[model samples]
Target: MRRLASFFLALYLASCSGPYMGKDLFGADEFVLDSYKIREGKLSILEMEGYSVAELGDEDLEEYQDRIHEDDVLRIFLYHPKRHDIVQAVSEIGNSIGYQVVGGEISLPDISSVKVEGLTLGEAKKKIEDHYARHIQDMEVFVTYKDRIVRKVELAGLVSVPSVPVDGKIRLFDVLSKARVPTDANLFKSYVARDGALLPVDLNRLLKEGDMSQNIVMRGGDKIYIAEPSAASLMVMGEVARERVISLPSGFMSLRHALAEAGGIPFTGDRSYIQVIRGNICKPKIYTLSWEHVIHLPNDSLLLMPGDIVFVAAKPITEWNRFISQLLPAFGGIEFIGKQCGSWGIFVP
Candidate 1:
């Protein structure tokens, strides 16, 4: 009975101990790092300067394809000896709602819905003349074709790198290289939108894709967006060298590179048992593994992706309370001596 009672006593003491507190000399739990706490309430992603890109919707791009003059072309007049007001009036009349201006002096009979994205005055007139021959009773207007610079286009997406304001006559490769399109760009399945329709082009079939040169003409307001590599991505959090989304590449990018991109763990990091939260579905599914194995093991080079949250928990605190408890008997003995000394001192007084 006594043995059983003693066993119960031990169990009770164990239950009474705090989760973090231990009788040992040290604890294994770690203190929290400020960085581990995410910004709460509202998250504002600040755009990086010269690194921001905008995407256009299909509806906005559809306005440029309606029927112009029977012959569609563009034209421009330089030093026509006309006042600026006259020039402006003519340009407005050509572009008005009821009339479509194809090119120099070529106006469609009915320009109900005609818009052009990239065309100078000379070119515009040619388009009008080519497409709306029946609409114009008299095509006698003569305007000079001055290929003047007009509107500009915007391109963004996964690239070898990222840049902004990449103006001038840009090719597909130039923009791709400028954007630093990720290696994971699906060359076999690429898409561009025109008039509310997404046109998929195969990068391998350049001619079929309408790619005349390795370089494709960049229209003003044209944006080239690269896509994420795959739907399956992993979150690399907790004491990692890198903390951003890692698009799985065709070739291998080791764990070291991922860590390097994450800025590596701070000096205060607990090197062992780096934590990775997988899926993060209903609850954060935690995985603990040593750094050595992750770095050395071939299977540990897990591909990372966007929206993966990586966290490195601090080192566990040592169980100093356990050691303190062991010294309790010694403290008890000291108390008795202290009491006796008090009595002796009193008697001498």
Candidate 2:
């Protein structure tokens, strides 16, 4: 029974993917460096600079990120020329000299209120000391972040009404797990919008590759919007064992994973011209990786994300189907356009 079932499954897969089965791609060894296709209406890799995923040695967090916000607890130390009794009493007494920022200001013992909101620790300490200088001859003020109030980021898109709370020293990576973001969410486009501008955060690197450089500090009241890609799953087409759509994995799906999911590179699979099409439909980036390169490189050398389309090219895609025959060298990206058009205009590669 098991043999019969296996035979039937094999036959079914063969018939289902008969047209795509073919010999190895020509010039596999000849192709050296993986490069982009300029004529495929695909966007150049240079245009992806705004995304900032490829930067090196970037700072984890900036000094300005430590700026004061409302509802924060501040530990203030006071010094006086000859008032050791008053200083000791204040530190040993009421609220332990820890003051909370209320209405953008903290009410000290003598000073009515000192505005410290939107200021750094140094700026706040200077402001507080200046405010007290008017009343006291040589009073000093020191301020530090005793405790940051717990704040929640408004997580919008691709989740079940989700929001990630930050108690203290939280990161975008930590809260992303709390949000339970799906693999189908477009990590490349995900960002934290704060103060009406997007922060330089690359969710793809942080979530998929575990790149700490991209793990930005999370702030309260940040709007983290995770966008859905044009396609829910990656389209794996062209000369392979079985052309299909592969759902993205939680971490990342490499080219090997995609190939294995589609019953792997077949006996007749083309070993040349494996293209990984990324970016949007109208302006995609086609990364041409030969099978020789994939075989020799590390498994994670070519990790895939949602909205990626992997195409194992054989010969030119001339006579793919009746409609796409005229399209001329159209590979897996056709399906993306077909989906965007909401019509079965061209057959997917």
Candidate 3:
């Protein structure tokens, strides 16, 4: 009789200990949740407004023309009313095909090598025209830029293609579209690194607002980096049906939306005290909001920042009852094991 009573006592103690043991093993401290807070003033969404592309002026054209570099290929077309023979001769020598600029100079048959390296398209055409004018009258010279060899930019981060070969004048948006910016790209945080200077580029403004001013003209050796959105997120924990990390879209998020996305609070949770914990583990700011108050007063809705923790506290009586209910199953299992051990003549103190 004493052995049977002792066995029952041990089983009772084991059942009661299960909840505390589980708590110790799986305490809040056991799991190291992310505590990195999104610093204030570190992130901001760009204001979207309509904008227009500025008209390219003569100065812009002049600047673009000045970008001609060595090793570029130029096509020279010559037409003469009386000098068909000369034209034929030049075409035979491949000068009519294309002139490859080498060391700022181009070698033409029967004409002295001209230094057209640092010259604009107009200046280069004039030099070639002057050369042909000395030999043939009524010679029309048309210089067409064939291929560029020097100007190139490197695009990295959040783009499909990393290395982009730029041939002519291009803007920031042009390359981004051509390279295929990912949908999740943090365009507001994109930047251009040029000549040891980091220039902040708001691609969101350029795309949504049509802000052409934010569209910077790309240059040779420029490095463009479009970053992914910050990993800072809000977490819904404690008594929620689905505990999850809510990613803030465009750095803006609300408490109500986060809770809804987390599958809402369970019946056991205390809706009256929904806690929003902000800041790091060492220093946390806990703000409590009443669901009842928020429902009645829309203005009472809280805006949640990244790295905030929304914990729906559980009702004390409900949680205790839940713990006891979970322990009952273990007690029943232990009781069965005790009876089987006694039947097998296993010693019980």
Candidate 4:
């Protein structure tokens, strides 16, 4: 009775025009496939694609929003236009309101950080001239980069990266703000690559939450890849009442739910030969199962993840025939979730 009850939960079904033993599964044509039975311990539920949270350290977080970086040379040159005298250089300026002498921090994994102080353009320059540089006839104090860091950080995706003037310390947040990234751009999947290696840049924290710890300073010759989320869906095809593409819900969607959404299977649809082809089209695996038979405990649900292409089959994976050429066109039409199918195509040799 327990076994029957488990099977009952796994599926519930009937015919083509009518309701249809229950509709299900899919397979690949021309593509050589290695098949495996649905194991007792390892089931469909175990293969769910979910988000994972990682713990990060904030040891190098900047107390200030922006700071000067390595190989940067800054100077305080007080220039008085009223008195044509050589711009007097100052050792240090006093602590006045606006932006204080900002000693920016450098973040280099290979070498030690070299800190440099810089000041923004404002009345503060005049204040410095008024108090110290020289009795101001005309407020003429200046702060400029003696040696500016000039290079391009290539950014790809929806964000249009402008030529950011690298005066001193340029951070990730600085670039993103000017990048004109769309509101719909998916930050979670974005990553930064440097020197042929991926940098540990969690854009979600920096962009969405305003987390300063993740706002690492940008370096020259860096490549940033930004991506948008794929259209969330599941493609259901073959031997069903209404073949359709179902939108992925916020929560889990089971085979039963999907079949129901497709208005159940017809008589032509095979109940014993249900095949669930998952993963990407280039390298995908097909799982064959019988909805009529008794499935194990937790596996009864048989939930489907986003982008999972649910299809029906006339025969099981083991009995898949190479002559089955009609499915080739349908399989090729499948669009993977957030990924390209690549160059490989399923064709008879």
Q: Which candidate is the best by TM-score?
A: 3
Better of 1 and 4 by TM-score: 4
| TM-score, model 1 to reference | 0.34
Instruction: For residues 207-318, write the lDDT of model 3, one tens digit per residue.
Output: 6557676676776788888777654467888878999987653344556777788888889787876776665566565665667644553321345665678888777667
**Candidate 4 lDDT for residue 216:** 69
Residue 165 Cα positional deviation in candidate 4, in Å, after optimal superposition:
6.8
lDDT for each residue of candidate 4 in 240-259, tens digit (9 for 90 to 100): 78889876422235567777
Candidate 1's residue-wise lDDT over 87-171, tens digit each? 4554554444323234423332343333443454455555544443454333433343223334344444555443443234554
TM-score of every candidate: 0.34, 0.49, 0.52, 0.37
C-alpha local distance difference test of each model: 0.42, 0.64, 0.64, 0.51
Clashes of each: 82, 3, 0, 13
Candidate 3: pairs in clash: none
Worst 10 residues of 1 by lDDT: 40-49
**Against the hidden true structure, what lDDT does model 2 obtain?**
0.64
Residue 74 in model 3: lDDT: 80
- The TM-score of candidate 4 is 0.37
